[model samples]
Target: MLQVLSSESAQEILSTLTSDPGTASEIANSVDQSVQNVSYHLDRLCEADLITPTKTWYSQKGREMTVYALATERLVVQFSDSTD
Candidate 1:
C-alpha cells in the first residue's frame, strides 16, 4: 500500500475516496483532474487493494456509476528496532 501511495496523484485520489465513495468522473471533478487520468489511477488503486467498488448507481443521463471506497480505514507501520 505504501508503494502504491507513493504517487502524489494516487494519494490525492485515495484521500477523496476515504471521505466518501464516488465514481471515476466524480473523483476527477473533486480532484480537479481529467476523467481519463482519474480512471487510470482508480484502476491502479483497485489493483493494489487500496480501494474497492462499494455501490452502483445511475447518473442523471442514465449512465451507470460505480463508487469506490477505501478498502482499509487505517494502516500502521512500525519498523523493527533490531540491530544487525
Candidate 2:
C-alpha cells in the first residue's frame, strides 16, 4: 500500500476518495484536475488493487446518474517500530 501511495497524484486522489467516495468527475473537481487526467490516475490505482469502483445510481438535475465508491478494503496500514 505504501508503495502504491508513493505517487503524489495517486496519494492525493486516494486521500480525497477516502474521505468520501466519489466518481472520476467528482474526484477531478476535488483535486482540481481534468476528468481525463483523473481517470488515468484512477485506472492506475484500480490496477494496483488499491481501489475499487462500485456502480450506483445518483439523482442529479432530476436525472439518475451512475457513480462509484472507493472500497475501504483496499486500504492497509502497517506499523513498525525501530530505532535508527
lDDT of 2 by residue, 1-84 (tens): 566668888888988877777878789899899989888888888887777777765666665533545666465576777862
Q: Give me the overall lDDT of model 2.
A: 0.75
Candidate 2 ranges with C-alpha deviation above 4 Å = 1-4, 58-66, 77-84
Instruction: Give the Å shift of residue 39 in candidate 1.
Output: 0.7
The TM-scores of all predictions, comma-separated, are: 0.87, 0.68
Candidate 2 global TM-score: 0.68
Best by lDDT: 1
Residue pairs clashing, model 2: none
What lDDT would each prediction earn against the true structure?
A: 0.89, 0.75
> Model 1: per-residue lDDT, tens digit, 1-84?
677778888999988987888999989999999999998888889998889998999999999989889999986677887994
TM-score of 1: 0.87
